[model samples]
Target: MSTEKCVVCKGGGTIELLGAQCPFCNGTGEYTKTGESYLKSHICQCIFLDRKTCPLCGKKCHHDTPNKPKILIGPV
Candidate 1:
């Protein structure tokens, strides 16, 4: 286990205002990845501090398209 917080909610386990659980950590504020290959990976802590959505439209945004709002993650 890591002491680091979730990237989406900043350890709150849920998105602010929306009242929805973080899709990344699933509201646990912790991330762990496992695979069949003898290797495991974890998300960087810095990701938590990065902006998740566009400040203008309040929609999910990315650097790839500064003026467009796209679905970063699909339904899971």
Candidate 2:
């Protein structure tokens, strides 16, 4: 397993919020392997906005009609 500091608050795990502590990391600055890697752990919300397809399988669903749903067939 690999260990690394929190990238959100730059290892301090806390962000100044009008003299209040950051709620994201809770001032710990430490995190462990919970399925997500350290490199890809810190991501902004823009990632979701830029995504138009599945990142894992790189598949895009096409909907023929608004009422009909797109079916995805693949191995999980």
Candidate 3:
């Protein structure tokens, strides 16, 4: 986990950045894991525009899921 100044809101943590889920990998960012696959939370929007990702699996976000804060990783 790294903390660089946010490019959008400039670190306000309030700005919403534009992004797309990795379609080829369903936001898993990775092609495959050694054993278990990554997963996202049904209660938390796991995709952030450029910040945190799925800690366990490194997925950005699921494409089929709505791009809402409730599921993605952006601030809510």
TM-score of each: 0.40, 0.30, 0.20
Can you rank all candidates by TM-score, best first?
A: 1, 2, 3
Pairs of residues clashing in candidate 3? 45-70, 45-71, 45-72, 46-71, 46-72, 47-72, 47-73
lDDT of each: 0.47, 0.40, 0.36
Clash count list over all predictions: 1, 0, 7
The best candidate in terms of TM-score: 1
* Global local distance difference test of model 3: 0.36
lDDT of 1 by residue, 5-55 (tens): 655566777767467886667788774342211111222222223456543
**Which stretches of candidate 1 lie above 4 Å from their native place?**
32-76
Q: Rate residue 27 of model 2 by lDDT.
A: 66
Pick by lDDT: 2 or 3, better one: 2
